[model samples]
Target: MDKAKVLETRRLLAFIAVFEEGSFTAAAARMGMAQPALSIAISKLEAQLGTPLLIREPRGVKATAAGLLLSQRAYEIIGLIESTVEEVATVEQHPTGEVAIGLPSSTAAVLAIPLVERLAKTYPGIRLRLVESFSGYLWDWLLNGHIDIAVVFNQASRPEIISTPFAWEKMHLIGKALPGEANAPIEAGQLTGLPMVMPSRKQSFRDTIEHHIQKQGGTLDVQIEIDAGHQLIKLICSGRFYSILSPGSVAHEISTGQLQARPLAQPLERAICLAQRRLRHQATAVRCVTDELLSEARALIVAGVWDARIEAPLCT
Candidate 1:
């Protein structure tokens, strides 16, 4: 048999319908065709294949052995075709199927929580996945297609990725001061001799802090180097060490007295940027997530909930 002649789509459909409905009359009604026409179509289909396709009884019909074999193959083919149609339609409508985002751990905790919640509520079907890593790792993942977008520091060197400033946060010192020192405003040099829990120097914020310290002719007395914001907060609250972070990460802690946030006399600010691979088209889901993150960031800035001075930067 010619493979092309044997694989008639309409014949396979007709055959399956009859097999499923158990009679030509029933199949015809389901298919919106007359019983005689449906029977004729089935007869012609079986004759073309040179096989007895059905066993007729008084009340209904059953597939002959050849009919049973063809039925299985027909189902597989029909399923694939239907799946292909759905996939094509989905691609046409959304263009991007799903989006994965890489975010800094601190940013995910302080900024991404509400954005993700809003996304779940508003666009439930748009598949969104997040991987929380440090800035360096997140940057690598974004460029490698492990993630579609990244929320990261503006200072990261990624000429290959398109970076846009989405938000800005001022860095601040967080600590549990000794008696009477909590309310006293301390100079940048005052932090020199204190035991400090600081982020790894590889972090952009660490560089900013170090720059400010040197400008003030002071040095950071590093007792611990922890990268995660919550861990830094916990260490500070335990009165074991003092750490520096963007005010956004510790605002709630300061407000609740779990920690105290003080402005550094020397201003240190970091821009937060949304990045995607350069020249790569973004999906609807990625765009939606980025928009929501910016919205939440603005709200936090306005409400002073994050305890930071927020600035919007102009991108050239």
Candidate 2:
């Protein structure tokens, strides 16, 4: 590349840092340069463009209208450069790197083990790191680039994220059954006064459940709040409280007859989403592990182990 072109690219990066941070000192520190040097670079950039890109203010600086347009274009240019470099580096690659994935506790309970096994067997060079939390945390991690991939529930629209529908799981009423009692579907109205063990308010699925119940003129009498899915299930199994969960969440207990699950008369379902950062470059290792995850989920759904309907086919 030409020397002038290289300097222009550097100036663009400097402008982006200052524009986002809104402070020359912070942007200078972020770029590992002296504050004076960063300011001079920005001045030179403005002079070259024949316009003022930013206005100095008491707090720091604010972008001019022209500056905003340049910042947006700069991001596109930088993103394209980064993705191009990563793609070229992966040519003839054996995918030897770590890929971090986030999953909600409910999905991780069943999907984690199989995903690990498949990756180890098929792509030994690819190391897998799993972070388990609720869907809300998982969404944050995915957007902030803390994780390469995530399995979330009913993800909302966001420009930074690219999510695909994985499945739709039907919610059920789960609790310990009385002796000689037959498990039957429960009416939505019947949950009005049910003493339920529920997830914390921060959890997205908790809001989904609340919305459904409230829509039916029912309110949950929550006796306990537990964030961890496994612990919540344990509390429910003690025969002290009931919870609304998907069959997949309590598949083991349901199979062993330790806990019985009753479907709702009017089905309530939640979407399982596979999410990733929209602008981040997808490396070979990341793509390989994502494929393995999709395959494992498909196999589980097909074998009737996870009681969910596939919303879309796996990505190739």
Candidate 3:
């Protein structure tokens, strides 16, 4: 079988939809196709690959390991194709292209607005798509061709992910106002006793926090684990539990006087970077977006819009 025929976009998308929806009937409904047609597509794909991807259960269906792997890669494949088409259609003067950027919630809160505003004014023809996720997933998306660029707190040790230093972000311990000491810096040793909520271990930031605590002869007293950034910010605003985060993640709450934050006595810092896929054809639109992100972020820092410090190699 020809390799090109083996990985048809339609079939890959169909299989991924089924894998996500967990049933051909449901996937087909979501995709606006007949259930039998969806099933046939999946079967044809399996035949071409010479492997069974679906394990039909009593109630619905589940993807086998192979199916899951393909589903993950399929996202990248489809995204790359879309980006390539858009890039080719884009012009230099009237650069009309779409750039997909994955940013952590912290960075997204601070950079997304300014970046969008700048791009809108500078290159109105360019379209921007912002995705917020933990650093680990962002790294994977960058590697797998799911995103054009990423502004991440921590980068993965992948040679294929080209990174340029963006800035140094200071982490904070945020929650209810302390008893008569609202401005007091929270000590690392004391953090082991505070009830906290943070991202799950799947997120690289959580591990970074834990590693910092352990190095300081303490540990995170995490009461709950959640991966969503908005929920974590909501928890900080609730004041019921304390969480380690950057001020940028909850800038609205902090600015509105709805929340209070203090830097750790032993400040925890993470280096943020602008990462792109190495050895891949990078679109000019993508480069323009990346440049805009750095510029906006630096301006925000200098203007105190974001409580982060700009590090070396600030531009490009």
Give the alpha-carbon lDDT of every model.
0.72, 0.81, 0.79
| Candidate order by decreasing TM-score | 2, 3, 1
Give the clashing pairs for model 1.
none
Q: What TM-score should be assigned to candidate 1? A: 0.65
Model 2 residue runs over 4 Å out of place are 1-83, 178-183, 312-316
Best by lDDT: 2
**Residue by residue across 44-105, what tens digits does model 3's lDDT show?**
99999899999999788988888877865776676678667766675335766677889888
lDDT digits (tens) for residues 1-316 of candidate 1: 5866776777777887788678888788878988888888888888888989999999999989898787766766765665456556776564334668887876776667777787778777767787887776777777655787888886553434567776677666777664235545457777778788887877766777887877888788888987776677788899878876775666677777777777676667777878875323233455666677778777876876655445664464
Candidate 1 local lDDT, residue 84: 59
lDDT of 2 by residue, 1-316 (tens): 4534633778988998898678999899889999999999999999888889999999999999898777766766666665567668766766677788998888887788888888899998888889998888888777656898899988864534568887889898898863223667677788877789988888777887888888887788998988888899998899988999888888888999889888876778888988875444355676788788888998999899888888653455
Assess every candidate by TM-score: 0.65, 0.78, 0.69
Error of 2 at 277 (Å): 1.4
Runs off by more than 4 Å, candidate 1: 1-88, 91-96, 156-159, 178-185, 279-281, 313-316
RMSD of 1: 18.2
* Ten-residue stretch with the least lDDT total in model 3: 277-286
Candidate 1, residue 198: CA error in Å? 1.2
**Whole-model lDDT, model 3:** 0.79
